[model samples]
Target: MNAIEKLQSERQRVVARLAEIDRILGQYEELQRIAESYLASGASHTADSGTVTDSVKTQAEAQREPSVTEPNLPRVKSPKTPMVEFERVVIELLSEAEVPLDRSALYKALLDREIVIGSPDESSDLNTLSARMSRMKDKVVNVSGHGYWPKDRAFLPGGYVPTGVDDMPSQDATSESGLV
Candidate 1:
């Protein structure tokens, strides 16, 4: 190939690589936003180390097997407590990273910065946070085998123009028939 042809090929390759990098970066940013939203929702609850009080358990049992005249059931108090402060710290870390970070990476980053949320005593806390985000996948982003990415990108949005694919129905062709 001539020098001009060679340079043109190199430029095209560089542009393709840059586009791929941008897509990856975009996925990371979306994940970060999801993590922040989870923390901000105040869903982080701590488990109590102590066993349930005997009186409370007894009362619960009595309510379960009610007499013919009594229909009221005893309300059970949750053993968990909200860790609002810790949640805020985790959210802050996620916001600062502005990228999709695995659980281990996030924990390490927080530790390096001396963030108290993922302290040794609360080693499994980060897992809980991840679980919370995972549960909300449908409403936010689809987090399957590849972690999280915006759903619309995987599936074209309404009136989208698809390119670089095999034979498929054109957007205008479908809409013109009023069949959608």
Candidate 2:
């Protein structure tokens, strides 16, 4: 067989492996969510009796105090922390890099940093990252020939303007105007 045929065959195998890995990762994430939910709900039972006890109820009752409450007042829950802060991480990485990094390179960098990515409902995927970068036109600029670079380095001494930054006015103007 020709070299092109061999390469195509190899590509097919690699794609299959990637799909399998993705499936396994999905299962792993499901199991992780289940375990976390169980732990968060404080699952406990007697060894011999195998009966569940209400630990939260016991604790709340012990700490309960009498307080005047208005009949019309509504109860509010505290805000939840973010599940993943990937946008900040990417912005920091892109800003710190000396050269522009493509999507694959950025993904590898994130993985090396122990940031779990590519799972469903996660922003670390390339599509999501690209959408975010596109929205953050001021912070990142896409070079014509090169990849994405920090906006500060958009000028290349060739009198060429980056794509999206052209429409966005000066950051100073935006801040002063407070329209951004």
Candidate 3:
């Protein structure tokens, strides 16, 4: 072959090698992109798992610890004595009465005993006495429909009296009579 033809053949071979190199570089770029995407996806998945584990651990810890407050917890008031002096006076008045005294009667009894002598404030209304009676009904004494009664009437000095005439005698009376 002549020199020009040989030179032409060598140039064609060089051009083909350059095209192969370009194709290999393109493939390498594609592989590098896929690897980067996979790494990012793996990192995101790990982060999500870590967050879920941390949340579950926090919830478990909260449930395991004791609470500071509980519902319907009974609270004892401070300076806890059996009964106040005013409450005792009221009980004394009820123990002496033959019939069930209403709230007004109880108030009058209090005034007679000089326990609640006079109004303390300018409002000076009967509502204050009514409120006190309500508090006594709920807290200090046991009250029936009509009036207030002492809780431990059996222990009182005068003893208990039946409110109604038709009411039967107590178990003590029946046992004493040998009805059983």
Candidate 4:
């Protein structure tokens, strides 16, 4: 083919690829907008058309706590112990307990003492508690099957026997690293 014709064909291909890239970029931008809207409103959204579903709360509504007369309102955040206070409470609870408490039992105790605030949705509270506890390696040890134990005490809670059945890697391992 002639040199000019070949150059034109290459230019056309480049233009077509650029157009395709622009179309893909537009799709990503739309998806990002949809995600931001969903997060801001705490509302469910359909990706295909970016339509709202009826399940979740609006941003304004979520921020405002509903009255008792309005029982069907979306869940709201409850008053919670500040993180520093929460750490103290956990230490106190684990130290005083006669038996090691599993995650669920620990959650119940926190709710009972009002050390950790309760919410309308209990499962979310449990999840939050679990996440917080997972970070507390220096303060507590989650001995498998036995439950949480204060790290400083260096003793298992009463009524828990070492059966050699699901021990941590080693006592020395835990003590040396300051994490069990």
TM-score of each: 0.26, 0.37, 0.32, 0.43
lDDT of 1 by residue, 5-39 (tens): 88776666555454444544544543454445457
At residue 43, give the lDDT of candidate 2.
60
Candidate 3 lDDT over 1-180, as tens digits, reads 899988766666555444444444544543453345456444332233433123223334434444323222222111111125556676677767654567777766765654432355424624665655566753334345556665433212223334452333433232222221
Cα deviation at 38, candidate 4, in Å, is: 30
Off by over 4 Å in 3: 1-83, 117-125, 138-145, 152-180
Q: What is the lDDT of residue 152 in candidate 2?
A: 57
Collision pairs in model 1: none
Ranking, lDDT, top scorer first: 4, 2, 3, 1
Off by over 4 Å in 2: 1-84, 116-124, 154-180
Where does candidate 1 stray beyond 4 Å?
Answer: 1-82, 116-126, 129-180
For model 4, how big is the CA root-mean-square deviation? 18.8
TM-score, cand. 4: 0.43
lDDT of model 4 at position 9: 62
Query: What is the model-wide C-alpha lDDT for candidate 2?
Result: 0.50
For residues 18-49, write the lDDT of model 2, one tens digit per residue: 44445445555544544454465566523434
The deviation in Å at residue 24 for candidate 2 is 16
TM-score of 3: 0.32
Clashing pairs in 4: none
Error of 3 at 54 (Å): 75
Residue pairs whose backbone atoms clash in candidate 2: none
lDDT of each: 0.43, 0.50, 0.46, 0.59
